[model samples]
Target: MTRCDVDSVVQLQISVSAKRLLRRADGPLRLKQIQEMVIAKLGRAVDHQQLLDVLQTSAKNGVPRFFVDGDMVGLTQRQRPGPRGCKAAGESCPLQPESFEAVATQAQMAQISKATKKLLCSLGGCMPLDDIQDALRVNGWDWKHEQVLHALQKSAKNGVPRYVLDGDMVRLAEGPSCCRRAQKHAATELAAFLQETEFSSCPWNSALSLSSFRGHGEFLQHVVQDERHSDGRPRFEVRKLHGADWIFATESAKLRQQVFEAIQALDAEVQGRPKKLLDESEDMAEISRLGKLMQDWVSGASWLTCLNHTTLVDEVPGIMTRVHLFDGDGIEVRLHMFMDPTETYIHNHRSNFFSYCLSGRYWHKIWGVPDGEAGLDGGHYFVVNRAKDPSFEHPVGKPGHLSVIAAHTHQERGSYYIKAVTPHTVQPQMDGNVATPVLTIYIKDKAPGPDTLVRVANKQELASLQQQQREQQTQDCRLEGRHRLERLRAMHDLTVLTSHSALRKKPRAGVPCKPSRSSPDIAG
Candidate 1:
């Protein structure tokens, strides 16, 4: 078959597998589980990233009639997904004013006018033009830049309290005082300049001389280096440091894109090369190439995007990751973020992976089980039970001795190389009341493990493992719901604050400012 035909056949197989899996399950299946089933059906593994791409495409096209509920994928009861390109729901749907395409009709213009007023009012009268456009887009109106600016200009020409176009942003004429606007504009411009201008050297660079690092900040005031001799066991240490300028959210997003593209390109190139010709050292060189690409790409992005995408893993609480994977030979790359006050059960994977810390600190423990006895026993049994089956009363065996492969509290951008069979547990290193975010990138070799928790112990452990896992699933759902509500509440509060500010503004001349057409403000 041609490549396109092969892809079509694979797609068909995937669709069939998804249908079969959903039919057998009573509820939505975890994405990890679904991927496992699909892989088994295919008889050949597909990249995790490729699976996500398929799912994302399916979602966009409303194919196979599936819906994503957090990390789970399920067949929606609805015959079709919700209408796309539709504005936010409610009577105040910005689409009420005008259709996305044509010039705003009189009634439509009125609706747009009212919506804009409400938006500005909620924004305390004036906001960036880009922000205004974002609000419109969120409300489902896709107006072009020219269209928005034209409308703003028209409104100014009319006998109303017009919006002032100040550089890239627009502000309500009656909003913040001229002095306040000037101050804000200057600060905004300065911030933009700072963000855009590339620096010659980053303060966080690990290669800086010891004398240069002296008295840089209060945090480094008591800097003490460990003079202890190196042990043979894996000892994590800083491999690289991304300076503050390079660690923003927008910068992270750009880096992720670059890293993803680089991986995809590298995989394609490596696949065509003869396996016999490529030695271990050559493979390492290829990986180093990818790393260098990521470093080069990270120069201009913001750290805020990295934080924004920091998501809690569906199957594991206290563990968060921003993942990007590549096809061919199966490589999964992720930005793993750990939070404090975490209790994580020890588990092992069947892939050699590399981890590099981006920020914060974490307590790392690696355990090595004896060859004959490869599962949890003794005090460690509690950790296993807590992990696999918390409720079941299993006969606890005599405490087994586990060789500690490596254990340490790692801070800074430490690099850790973990073997496939080593079971480890990592938790946030606390500082007083808060647990700072521990950011790291994990590049796992080969396909991911089965959705079922791995245990080499006797069959007794398997008895209620699935049942226990099912019962534990609700926690993930609850967390997802709570996170969504929190974000919604924050947006609502911001809108309310802006609306009240608009209300308080004095009207131009003797005329009272027009009241917003939207419903009463949500309590801040």
Candidate 2:
């Protein structure tokens, strides 16, 4: 028996050479002739029947040959059957299409049915029942329309992957298999949309420590769960953005310009009033003004008014200008994506941290402890909830390096810190308290030419987007992030997540428990 490898594309029971063939004969021939011819030429005693079985099994048509007076055979595969017409490239191989049923079991079909309904509802409920069934039909699903309807009615309250709510109607959520880039943008847009549009007064809202940037899961979940007000205060469901998760109504691309304009309006009224003068009492009016302006934008009340187009002076200390790195054509490519994420970084003195990576490599870190592993031997990142955050500002103990006040045993309430440069080191610089090592990074700038540390950029536009989500949406995104964080834990490859079994009580440097990833979103 002959085996096929890269050396040749041969079949079993044959030892032939391409050069020996010379296209054998332009016309076709029989197997017996070639076998006999081989015997005659090589003086080898090759069995005719044995040769017939080999040819019949290996060649589709046995082989092609020149007839010697008509009663003969050939050694090529053409001996089996049809024409040797060449198929053009991309012509599908003759393999039959794999049956969908081969992959879809009864349970899978049920799941698809459920997922389909959820997707539809999330889309706005505008799609008729029949339309959904039709969608499945085109895709080769074997579920009945009733199956989909049942799933929708079942998960209407909590929302499944599909059938996300758009007001009263239901529509599809972005499917999981969508393109990665597009899906990410969609999630961001949707999260923003929900943030701008829906201000759910979730009882969880009180628990939500927004000032902390990242905090406990329960509080974050509270912020999301209250988006629609289960008590029936008019629902504002999240809309499907470009990706997997549904965004708040404010996230719509259609209203992006409007939202930015709204932020500008708020910015114009009173963006720069010195942080000192704007304390809670004296700045009460200003805070109200900014909030009101934001409300106007969310409400879509004003277009780009004279004030809307105007840029405000951002004297809100620490809310520095997010300057742009203009290219030759003066196109700004590198600018801070969001100022709010970094707000607590400036405010929290107790947060001992230092991290330095390129601008493209920042990531949000937050998660629970893993089982049976030692935590890192350094200052762990402490969660900061604006609601529960310390009221007074601490004096700068030292330029940027100090180790104190790491006393609180805050669990993994982390936020994203990306490397904006190379050889970055994110070490804690707080005084007192050594429960964990706060992972702060230092950057060495990867952008061209080296003008990185000046921090001269267009200040974060004091503008908010047109929020479209119902109040409940805000609750959804944060909670979802927490849930996703759990899955993300495995990705970090840190097995020493928790150490409950240890009897000797030692100071656990909590840094090891922080959520991280084996690979970052940006490619190396």
Candidate 3:
């Protein structure tokens, strides 16, 4: 044979040996390792440069079968004929059999490009090329790694490239920082609108229009669409109302509707009489019914959504999260989550309300003074006029004592009704262990009023209140609207998990396995 024939034979032998070695290996093999193994398998001396040249030539050809990444090498993953003798099986098969040897069509390239961009976005806009290939395979894309790369290259040829390949890492050419910033800005704008409107749904022209969103309408819509596709509950939803688009806070809207229906049913049963007039037995039965309603709502996935959209989340650091669910006419509903065993200062409410415990335990104390007495014997009185003073500065009063008129250990599913101007305080129960989180629902008989009174027993107690206020202000500054919503969702998820696990334990006969409640007179 001539010298050219001998060279051809050596190249074929080296290619087959390399392929065999790679196919047998568990993962990508180093170039040096491939050469050594191939030579060992051949049982003869072989030139390293010749092997490299053969591998490189094969990879550069139109029907490339090998992938060379720096010093590492591997067999390229190609789509094999399915069991049904087609590239895609079942209903996904094309009308005609597709040839594996043919180049990817324009439509195929476009689909690959779109999927690649989505994968990059989900991966924070950068990923190793191998990882991208593996992810594409996992997602059921039949395209080979070479096909994906070619499609990306073709898509970038005419304009600013959307993606860049550096060494083995594939990244978005423009990076993801700008996109994330725009998304956060859009979320902030929407959150601000919802907060300003008191979580009420608004027309598209009012909040989502280009003019209203300052020319970011398209981008905002994209952000909202992406959020909807995510695993977490979406922040805003667009609904058609009277043939026009309206923006609704997703969780708040659903919760408000549920509460409205519940209240309507209750009103029908009361027959125009004040709800407070229900005798003890009737009131207890109503409370139980409402408790069941709450239990059903909280047990579902929508409760997580409610926690996600709550505007008053994390209002008090380490103490409470008060979510305002609904406020209409003379009735308001609020959900409170208490994390610590701290007791609220003795205080009075400006409206009658019912408290239903959703989980955990607390000590409910009612205080009162004799009809002819000026004040309690050992209490420092402070009139809290939040209407006139947003700072919650307390007006001083003479020190006095207060008698504990009624005290009860409020357990899970327990409920209580307190009349307007009734003095009360709630201290979470601590039975020689860490404090359990307490969740409560409050239904008020009137619109929230600004005037209430708090009585502290000593200077230490007063100082603690001042410290709590300072901490709350600091926390409020640090937590943005989007972050607050995320934090609240996480907290709610953890609480639900713990509560569910506790409920799974063996139950005692004749005792209910329901959750706990919150402060009777606490303002939303």
User: In angstroms, how far off is 387's CA in candidate 2?
Assistant: 55
TM-score of each: 0.35, 0.16, 0.42
Task: Assess the local accuracy of residue 270 in candidate 1 as a C-alpha lDDT between 0 and 100.
Answer: 48
Separate clash counts for every candidate: 17, 108, 14
Q: What TM-score, to 2 decimals, does candidate 1 have?
A: 0.35
Using TM-score as the measure, what is the rank order of every candidate, best first?
A: 3, 1, 2
- Candidate 2 lDDT tens digits, 181-263: 32333334334434433232123232223322123333233223443323443222333335433312222222434434433
Where does model 1 exceed 4 Å of error? 1-257, 269-315, 321-329, 369-399, 448-524
Question: Which tens-of-lDDT digit does each residue in 175-274 have in candidate 1?
Answer: 3344234334332332343354332122333212223222222112211121111232211122234434221112334455666776776555544655
| Candidate 3, residue 206: lDDT | 66
Q: Per lDDT, what order, best first? A: 3, 1, 2
- Give stretches of model 2 more than 4 Å off: 1-109, 121-126, 150-524
- Model 1 lDDT, residue 229, Cα: 15
Query: Which tens-of-lDDT digit does each residue in 1-524 have in candidate 3?
Result: 01122377778888888877876773568888988887898887776556656775564346555655545676654333588555663323322212223446899888887887777665345667777778888999887665676576556645876666555566667645555754666666666665455334677666645322444355556656665424367777787889998776665435545655786565444444554233334455666677666655564444544443434444555557766666555456677777678877678877767787777778888886545564444545454544454344564655455557678877667788777678788888886788766777777766344367766555666667766666565343334567766655554454455457666874798876543433244222
Best by TM-score: 3
Query: After TM-score superposition, what is the CA distance of residue 16 in candidate 3 from its true location, in Å?
Result: 40
Shift of residue 372 alpha carbon in model 2, Å: 88
